[model samples]
Target: MAPAIMLAADAPKLSSANTGFMLICSALVMLMTPGLAFFYGGMVRVKSTLNMLMMSFISLGIVTILWVLYGFSMAFGTDHGSIVGWTSDFVGFGGIGKEDLWPGYTIPVFVFAVFQLMFAIITPALISGALADRVKFSAWSLFLILWVTVVYFPVAHWVWGTGGWAFDLGVIDFAGGTAVHINAGAAALGVILVIGKRVGFKRDPMRPHSLPLVMLGAGLLWFGWFGFNAGSWLGNDDGVGPLMFVNTQIATAAAMLAWLVYEKIRHGAFTTLGAASGAVAGLVAITPSGGAVSPLGAIAVGVIAGVLCAMAVGLKYKFGFDDSLDVVGVHMVGGIAGSLLIGFFASGKGQSDVEGLFYGGGLDQFWKQCAGVFAVLGYSLVASAVLAFLLDKTIGMRVPEDEEVSGIDQAQHAETAYDFSGTGGGLVGSAAPALAAESKKVDA
Candidate 1:
């Protein structure tokens, strides 16, 4: 034990090939932020497109500061009596160097910290879409900072930290089926519930403003996913790394096809929006199982997620919940499906050693996966709901009706995405006229 401890102390000094690969993977994951900006930017109305992009753009600044200050320590520092970290050994990445922190892994501790930080940055950005078109920019920014602190930090500690209960429970989230996707998805629903819907949610067309932007975002997200999935290994020497890379590609293609086909059948035409959305759905679903399932299993997961998410999007209208951009459907429902189904399809040549029930590994793993899903879903829902309620009462979650009708771009940001008729669409720099118009319309 003494020798092992000594070796651990020296781990941060040893580095070579594996460290290089991990750094590249981290860069790739970081690129997903800009990609997501485009993906979401194209989905909002033309009048508010730039505002949509800004929502995502701000995360790079806000979350990065929070991550270095306390996010990393809270997420990865040694457990402090079962709730959070006790020590700040790596605050500001003080002790991180070019060495292995774990047995056989050679990347520096900073590499791991920054890679995970990229994930934290993107998760809150994902929720911004649910509140688009109606939120005050400053208020929304404050809400995210607080929300990540109260919600994201604890959940990350619970699932991925050294002494996290979920980690000890043997939950096999290779990437972020639970920590990243499901957590954000549930929180998205909570914030949307508290914030209320856009002024004309059910009545307006609310079509995406730019198909090209949507496709560009989808393409970048797909490319960056190679890093997101393969980087989970923290090494490039083994077969597992390449295997995950191949599976990520196959799964996304399958999902894209499934979504386009679904759209063609139901809406009479294949759409660029459907393809982009479907690809993202596939990526989110495979993130957990990419390193644990066979190639064929990936295809299965991608197809199912695509079809299910497509159907689930209609839930906003059917149930009158107003999820806005279908974050709950694509991320929440899709994350659950992917995380849960790996119990049956994790098999075949060059596959995960722990086979699923279909390969006669018994029903144990399937049950374990279900347990993980429930834990993530339950905690995220309750915690997020409580947080939203508290923030709503304390600081206000939604903009006033007048502000909503005039567009948050003007009322909240002092800027307009377009100046169609000068006066910034006839409402800029003037709040009273817009308020009067809004009052006259009532349910506007």
Candidate 2:
């Protein structure tokens, strides 16, 4: 790609390079759901693994359909009172044409729509980790439908949409600190409250069955996050895109190190789980701030997120709320840190003209960041709590105690994650005959 492809002021049009880059970024972001599946799956007990995987996988199907039909319109259509977009503007993607470009950008409107669709798909999936093992699959599916409509769409409009309340307020969510991570993290806490703790809770060991799977999932998430953070720029030609990409890497590395160091000092050992969680915390922190911060700033954000998220994970045990996979800890805390830190770390030389406090800009940007974080956090918590309570009172939110103990994978899906019974294997059958003859001889 060219270092910079400047478009003429009078005759702006689509660029093939930007379109292809965004399409690839969309695909990369889509992969994160399955990556989340493996990540969450490996963290649960053996019996609940399939259910864990399914929770993340289900969003890919549900959200894609919803996005194409109406979610996109509600999020990015004509502005409506600075709160949401007009559903009539792009319902069914009705008014957009093949030749149309995204308002001021060089990519097709469809490319931007699809890119945003990937974001919609993963936000609900992020909550599944908190509701793992005991949730009814049907209820979870229904919740996905409801949550995206009531929570994700409106908040997305508030942050990313044109003329959005936060956008107009200059909240500066470079990616989705407010719209995605904080939104999902707060929702996770709400649902966990309504669902109650797992059957085992504090007593059960509940060790991860597969660390390898967790590592693999973490790797995929780290890889895909490049597209997630960088692609938010909506074009490759801007200098900010590369800066965001490098910042993402730097921050993740720093966060991982910070988490490992904290683990070594606090827990007596550096752990694979800590490394993975740390990396995720870093990624979450940089999502909203990467484009605006330098490498050094990214490192500061990453180290802070890693250490804080590491401590935050223990809050579930202390507070008596069971966030199954630490979504509240890593995503919410990290997102809040990243977003708020932008007030102090944002550089005027970067994408936005706003300079943060560290560069002598004072507390103006910091306060705006705080406002955005609290708005999304408060809205998501209330909305998600109400939805979860309603679902629990109506069709029910959790499985029966018997199902919970017996394994939800079988109860919900009627299939286990692993079946060890051999297909009358040739080696086993041959060994069985020899063993029987030896037993007969011994008896004689």
Task: Give me the overall lDDT of model 2.
Answer: 0.91
- For each candidate, how many residue pairs have backbone atoms clashing (under 3 Å)? 1, 0
TM-score between model 2 and native: 0.93
Cα lDDT tens digits, model 1, 125-231, are 88887777877677778877887887777778777787887776666677888888888888888777777778888997888878898899889889998999898
User: Which regions of candidate 2 fall more than 4 Å away from where they truly are?
Assistant: 1-9, 87-89, 423-444
Name every residue pair that clashes in candidate 1. 12-99
How would you encode candidate 2's per-residue C-alpha lDDT over 1-444 as one tens digit per residue?
A: 243444444455889999999999999998988999999999999889999999999999999899888999989988889988875757778888987899888999899999999999999999999988899999999999999999999999999999889999999898898899999999999899888999989999888899999999999999999989899999977699999999999999999999999999999999999999999999999999998888999999999999999999999999999998999999999999999999999988778888999988999999999999999999999999999999999999999999999888878886667756754312232465787799799999
Best by TM-score: 2
